[model samples]
Target: MAFKRVSLIVAVAENGVIGKDNDLIWYLPRDLKYFKDTTAGHTVIMGRKNWDSIPLKYRPLKGRDNVVITRDQSFQADGAIVVHSLNEALEIAKKAGDEEPFIIGGGQIYKIALEQNLIDRMHITRVHEEFDGNTFFPQFDENKWKLVSKEDHAPDHRHEYSFSFCIWDKIDDSQ
Candidate 1:
């Protein structure tokens, strides 16, 4: 079976930080809303740590199918489908009829997916500020991706930092 699209969705800081410890470092409500809105009906694949970071009340992420990747075979997330690998998670999503599953991650999962070239598109919320963090988004070659769209947002009463929502599609070498 094949998928029409498989996207990676994340919020990164100017310095490439994605999180601190196992939780998000910043509190950008707009970015959170964007994530929820964009991936509402799709399957969200995440690592065990990422799944763990989600508050209990929001586990299974209400409107999405939560696929959690973990090495521990006995580990079970009550409301999520547990898989041993990213490929396994993808297969579950594919079998569930999700054409465009989203890889919503922790540091390791993102690195593995990128290294395996399993991503088709990326939806990124670029926060325009540097932060101190232990986890980071992997660096990718800009030449290999085409920026499809970008919408910039300025800081306001509700938002502390300026940010931009950017969509990038992987460049097809065949063309």
Candidate 2:
């Protein structure tokens, strides 16, 4: 079966941490806006906790298909589709035809997607500093991917730290 375009979206610190205690460690309004603008019309698949981490007011992210992956078959997220596995989520995304599915994640989902070779590209926000966190972004072989684009942002009144928005495209050896 042909899979639709899939990408992983995340923000990681210098130490590779993404979150702590189920919440983001930093407050970067621009990064959040970048995320919203990029994933606005696409399908976004995330782990259950990641879905929950969104404030109750923003439970279901607007303007995109929100697929929450969880083990609980009875789990329900308002305005979001709850699925059991990554494959199921991808299948749903494929049915959408045009919009690519982006993995907006917690650590485990990121690791699984990378390991399963289910990602075609990556949108990573590289934070310039580190913070204490229990969750981390997974490590992967950098040689397997190519950096296609990047935009650096300097810290300002709204953004606490300097960061870079990086886009990586997966290299297909079969080509």
Candidate 3:
């Protein structure tokens, strides 16, 4: 079956930390808004742990199709679709008519997607500071991605750390 654009969206610290204890370590409201705005009408695929980490009130992220990947056969997520693998999740997203499906991850899921070469684009918020964390965004070869755009924001009364919103597109090796 044909698929539309597939992307990964994440926020990473200077040290590549994304989260800790299955939760986000920082409170970047602007970044959060950016995430919501960018993904409002698309499908978001995530690992089960990532799905659980979301607050109860935000479980099925509003205005988007939530597809969770889990290995447990009996697992169920109310208001969200649960699948056993990334490929299954992607299929669901495509069948749902999502023009661009996003992989909103926990560490392992991100690593798997990268290793499988399943991502076509990436939307990253690069936090300027580093923090102690158990979850890290998987590293990829910078040479294989082309930075499409970037917007920097400095810390203000509302934001603590400086950050840059970066958009990257995977280089088409077949070209």
Error of 2 at 168 (Å): 0.5
Per-residue CA lDDT of model 1 for 1-175, tens digit only, reads: 6799999999999999999989888888999999999999999999999999999989989889999999998999998999999999999999999999999999899999999999999999999999999999999999999999999999999999999999999999996
> How does candidate 3 fare on TM-score?
0.98
Highest lDDT: give the candidate number.
1
How many residue pairs clash in each candidate at the backbone level? 0, 0, 0
Q: Write the per-residue lDDT of candidate 3 for residues 82-158, one digit (tens) a residue.
A: 99999999999989888799999989999999999999999999999999999999999999999999999999999
Error of 2 at 30 (Å): 0.8
Candidate order by lDDT, decreasing, is 1, 3, 2
TM-scores for the candidates:
0.98, 0.96, 0.98
Q: Give the candidate order by descending TM-score.
A: 1, 3, 2
Per-candidate Cα RMSD to the true structure, in Å, reads: 0.7, 1.3, 0.9
Query: Any idea what lDDT model 2 has?
Result: 0.92
Superposed by TM-score, candidate 1 places the C-alpha of residue 45 at a distance from the truth, in angstroms, of 0.3
Please report, in order, the local distance difference test score of every candidate based on alpha carbons.
0.95, 0.92, 0.94
Model 2 bad stretches (over 4 Å):
1-4
Kindly indicate the candidate among 1 and 3 with the higher lDDT: 1
